[model samples]
Target chain A: MSEGKGGGETVELLLPATPERLALARTTGAAIASRWRFTYDEIADLRLAIDELCLTLIRPAQQEGEPRRLTLAYTLDGSSMVVRGQVDKPNPAAVNGDGQAPQPTSVSDLSERILDALVDEHGSERTDSQLSAWLRKGRSVAAP
Target chain B: MEEVFEIAEYSDDSTPVLSVRGEIDVSTAPELRDRLLGVAQDGYSTVVVDLSEVTFLDSTALGVLVSGLKRFRSAGGDLRLVVTGRNVTKVLEITGLVEVFPIFDSVSEAVST
Candidate 1:
């Protein structure tokens, strides 16, 4: 556990960059959201967002042919939770089904659409080496 | 923790129905994709996926559903969904897939429509 910029509680997890571990991430997110008294819908959004975040990274780590661990930083406070992560880009040759360099522009666009609809705020940055994304969800008024 | 994923097949008034319960995430989406596509390829003109009991659904699961929907529509068939719980509905709403697929309150309604 770490401290957020404003002294909020931050829970960080480092898990194998494998699809099997995605379930752990989802459950952990749900538990955190529940403990923070988020609504059912808010909790579901957190779980789904975490899933997308992990899925985006798993392929790239596998394509690298190296053991990789995904780091997830969740900053929680009374107002919101901000989730952040970074993932390496997969080898183009390994991901292409048609034997050409894989084009993932559309996938990135889809991810944006999903995060936008699910969270209060979201964005991602892509570089030659890795992709980093962040999403924030505001606490529901119904929360205790 | 054990992964809670199960897909069962049954016929509702001759319409093929896939009842999916538990989490549908990266690890389980492939199995769902296979079963749904199998049902469509088996010559069924209409397929209904019952997600009322599903505890969780992620982007991988959504992608699988989208692919299945395209397959069914191209073959002159359709994929309908029975979505009730907040877990499944929130994901669909976020992905804007609720508008893309025909949604029903129950398997009976999905099969009928």
Candidate 2:
């Protein structure tokens, strides 16, 4: 856990959606999770979900033929660390199939698993809040 | 932040025992995948990755493991991993890759058998 100033006890980092950057997010998340006292299992789940989200976001970027970014942010909350990120790809699972967008099968399945696991861990409301945060300000990860 | 990463090395014809240190996450997974791919390309018969030092794992790393194992196994080679951490072990168990790849408790034991 990296030490911070005062009692604010908040840590944040921004990473792109590339594989290399995704890897950094996982490593950074793990470190922050440890700093915030997340259980081993909690830390593992958070990392897996992060990878899945980033990959899913990648699929959309490929579809739009534009550069889409995955941004992850975090902070030390109370007991569990909150990870928030945007999969800049228009929710692959909800694609309209309007002949304008294509969704990758493996990646979506992987993304679903990631979302499902996170939902199980923190519940739908928390998941929604996390996603909302991402939509509002790139992405945020909070741990306490 | 401090980074924990290392290459798990081995040679062909010899039972490869890879020593993995630090957390196997999205960022560092490619390095691991490449290392395992090298072993497969070298035509090794058995590769045992030592993960006792690993403290964390994610699905991306899990995918790398899955594909790497398949690549070697398809060529009549094999990839086994030895992991002994609660979190790491649980990831394998949850992902159900433990059954896909032969698992062991230690490097010495993984190599002996």
Give the count of colliding residue pairs in each prediction.
Answer: 0, 15
Candidate 1 lDDT, B19-62, residue by residue in tens:
99888877888999989878876888679999998987776677
TM-score of 1: 0.84
Off by over 4 Å in 1: A62-66, A88-109, A126-130, A141-144
lDDT of each: 0.77, 0.61
Complex DockQ, candidate 1: 0.52
Per-residue lDDT of model 1, residues A60-122, tens digit only: 666566776677888886589888876555454444443222225544445566777788887
| Per-candidate alpha-carbon RMSD to the true structure | 4.1, 6.9
lDDT of 2 by residue, B18-52 (tens): 78898666568889988887777777767888888
Per-residue error for A103 in candidate 1, Å, reads: 7.4
In CAPRI terms, where does candidate 2 land? acceptable
Question: What is the per-residue lDDT of model 2 for residues A53-106, given as tens digits with 9 covering 90 to 100?
Answer: 555545455555555566655644444355555544344333443422233454
Instruction: Output the worst ten-in-a-row residue range by lDDT, candidate 2 chain B.
Output: B8-17
* TM-score attained by chain A of model 2: 0.59
